[model samples]
Target: MNDKMKLKQFFPMLAFASLALAGCGGSVSKTGIELSNLDQKAKPGDNFYQYACGGWIKAHPLTGEYSTYGNFEVLIENNNKQLRDLIEAMAKGQHEAGTLEQKIGDLYNIAMDSVKQNKEGYAPIQADLEAIAAIQDRKEIIAQMAKLGSKGLPGYFGFYIDADIKNSSMNLLQIGQGGLSLGEKEYYLDNDSATVHVRESFKAYMEKMFTLCGSTPEEAKRKMEAVMGIETRIAVPSYSAVQQRDPEANYHKMTYEELKKDYSGIDWDVFFSTMGIQGLKEVSVGQPEPIHEVEKILAETPVEDQKAFMEWKLINSSAPYLSDELRACSFDFYGRVMSGKQQDRPRWKKAVATVEGVLGEGLGEKYVEKYFPAAAKERMVKLVKNLQDALAERIKVQDWMSDETKKVALDKLASFYVKVGYPDKWRDYSGLEIKDDSYWANIVRSNEFDLAYVIDKKLNKPVDRDEWYMTPQTVNAYYNPTTNEICFPAGILQPPFFDMEADDAYNYGAIGVVIGHEMTHGFDDQGRQFDKNGNLTDWWAPGDAERFEARAKVMEDFFSNIEVLPGLKGNGALTLGENLADHGGLMVSYTAFQNAMKEKPLQTEDGFTPEQRFFLAYANLWAGNIRDEEIRVRTKSDPHSLGRWRVDGALPHIDAWYEAFGITEKDSMFVPKEKRVTIW
Candidate 1:
């Protein structure tokens, strides 16, 4: 659901839902479920995930370049090749200056030019570093931070313009807790061996980066300590992943005057003006406690220490785009130490990712033309409709939810804004200039261009429901509660997820579940707070709301008991929304599969019934090998469960799954019928 894509077992046929009819002719066409992908030695009743996906996991072992390699990474690898070709073609061709093609080609070529990057070393960021060093007062520090923030190097806190939770229509500037380099608060606070190792490696990494940025060893150590001290103080007040999920707790709308009166440590006017934002009225302060802590740190910390932290921020942010040594050093700590990746991605892959980040929609427009088919979009529309109908049917029969709540839930479902394949309006990147400058310089300009777009074009404006957060070429989907929308980009509509030759059972379990998963997000713990119009309002009857929470607690508790790794258990509260979505998706998509079967019943393929194949297809979507380091990292950071748990931990709650594979009470993974989660 984040940004990963999946591609497996390509087929020749271009047909859609009609492909299921191929099984009605007394024989199955290619079911898109490869027999080779199944582990014959494993038993479904004991370990469904291992049985269904063990072969795929064994076949695609984790490589040095990846911490977690899965079906998603396979698709990413394929998409990378496609993107490389497109950018390489543009680089070879002579296009007009200022054109998107020119910008795309120039940016990729600049990023890939290792010789030039190594020659430039840290020279590109030297002026910015010196400017940070020259800051004398708190006002100057705030201004410098804002200047760096505009180029995406946020310091103490970060802000974004998005639909206000309550307002839902007007975009509001929201600032939140930040400044932690290791991301989560647990990494800094945890006494576990793994967390301690990561923290120590990060400290060493900071010192090395400071030394590389022209500091002596002693000076670098001092600066590293200063930055770590400020960050640790910020972390003390920062919200945990679970706590941040509460919309009501996070939202704190305050006027500019109130902000100045309450958090008067820094000059807000200077901060906004430096970022080219003028006459700001009000903003939603997300996590006031952390911001309060940040204010205290800025006021109490010495000027020299503050300057060192700011300079370190600049150096740290610029390291990846700097010389080979800097990039490797950064990766050694982040990629190798934190995530256990043995090597960095290829230069072409890095360059392609950079171009995609800056000019995604511009490149996506061309990508859809070349790779995305009109038929795919048309088929996806039909699939979404079926899933919606299935979810509505389930909603009508929910005994726990009262009639009043059901009516409103149905209304919200009907109001969904579904975007498939691509956006009707492409983003205008004409103003974005890419020049024959240093790679880091071009990246800085790109960041500035993006910030300007958000501030100038979108800030305080009405929310554009049609506007997509992800580009068409991204192999991911998202459900934004403020928009009450679900988007499936063209990049995910390929083999495995949405195979042209797969039967309805396969498609229903794979992409059908994906569609349902997003739809269910609207009814998840967080999304349920927002009503049909996407405003953060309580539309539920008081009794029904209480019952819903009680039911959701069951799901939370169920996942909390699962041991993802040795001694480390899952954080159910942190992953509740996604877990609920996964459960609801199975219920909704399975019903839709049955509805499709009413018209055309699918025959057994590869010695498995339709129901068994459905579950297998669903499990195949999550097949992958992951490093233990990644397991711990994702457990802390990712909202979704790990891949193995997504199948094994989730399927035990599904009633039909037991019937599909004849799972008995004696089975180790079986959940008592009374204890199984009933909420959708």
Candidate 2:
């Protein structure tokens, strides 16, 4: 639900690249069955999504956050493995002290270069921290925080939400829920044995951060304990990064003046200066609950502990966003607190993501020009249209859903604005810079710049067509009904999805279905509540809507019955709409392929028929392996079904599965025609 997710994490440009590897589904040597006919069609290499995401599945076997298999996350971990290979090659390279040759070994030549000296390193900060006992005035605390904290205030202790209660009489404050952790809330609060172990590990990490901050072993331990408590207070808030950014859910506006009267200890003037030095003078605090609670807690805290809390806040905020020295020092604390790892992030992991995030689309544009090619993109457009056509046709034929519902559904489909490649307007980063000494400053400036962009846009006319989300280098996609748009970034444009050189069967089976998937989002259960204009409202007749919901209920129960992990309960209500979309996406994508083959006088090109390949391509998209813990996490949080269920669930409704595989009741995926679930 964070802005990043809702923005654009799709694979339009990348999906087209999938076109290049099109129709390459060659036959698989089936178990126990000998293939005497070499001329017979083959099952594609990317058969079951369960298998394709095998490595990722195995790694993220446990689930925690949003439901389904962490499809997007699985890709990220796989990408990290690729990045690790680059790191390995660089580490093992034998070369001269300085040369472009050695540099080519990895992303940066000095990535692991030892510093020539530790001039002005930890000793000064250590001395200053000892002086903290002398300072008690709130203004002095602010000054010390600015000098030491990376974020000034907001950046401290993972995150510091401004529950500024300056204007409200009721005194409710909005607390930001999440910051950096394993992304699971229980990582901090859960008292279960595993959670306890993680907490102890976190405490150990806190000591590591203290060491980085120039504290001695004793001081580091003491400092970390202090820091951990402050962070826990912040963490206990009722929102996550996801919830805070969800405009659909969290749009309650309030005033600063109201916030001040409610939240304690924070002088309204000083607090406003920290958040928006210029803007707050004019506008009141929006929501003030978190600050109100924070104030109450601070009032009850013993005088001896106040300094400790304030100093820790200074360290937390100042550590991450300042200079690399501070960043490194800060991570010493943050890394251990969140992950239990005490080591610094490998330079490549942090910098490459930043570099690629910034320059990905520009570089991707070139990469596509050279390797992915425009032909692939153009061909994908045709397939996208074909999938759209297929959906439109399905709407026309849906028996359970009345014609009234179909009309509205078709309009939503027809209105889908496909955003492929990068945004028309790239984010303006001219104000941001990479300074040699002030990494923290640069980060703060960048954040401020980005925050300004979002805030400024709120006052202006909504830029509906602009891209406010992911760069093309990311490997995911999403459907945003609020904007009535489906975005496909350039990041996912390569591999597995489509291959221009591959046959029509593979291409259609892959990216064509993907296009269908995004298309289905427009008409998903929740999406159906919104009109074509992207405003949420009931657009369908009550009778027709009820029928549609009844059909979707079957899908909901199906997913509800399937346990993604052993004991964790699946949230069928949360995931119902997405399940519906997946089922429909499969149907729409399959039908498109069926139409594509109609004129070809098609025969089985692989050992498996085209229809079989079609479904395989689908399962392949979701293929993965997972850790049991990861599965538990995903089931508790993720909205989509597990990879296995996604494949098995969708197959029964696909009539083509029966025709192509000669599937009968004996086959697990087969459902009698009477029992088949269908709705447009």
Q: Who wins the lDDT comparison?
A: 1
Q: What is the C-alpha lDDT of each candidate?
A: 0.84, 0.51
lDDT at 418, model 1: 86
Pick by TM-score: which candidate is best? Answer: 1
lDDT of 2 by residue, 563-671 (tens): 6655555656645656677777778887887788787644565455666656655556665444454455555445566566666666666677667667666654456
What is the TM-score of each predicted model, taking all chains together?
0.96, 0.70
Give me the displacement of residue 576 in model 2, in angstroms: 3.8
Q: Where is the poorest 10-residue window by lDDT in model 1?
A: 1-10
Cα lDDT of candidate 1 equals: 0.84
RMSD of every prediction: 5.6, 8.3
Model 1 ranges off by over 4 Å: 1-29
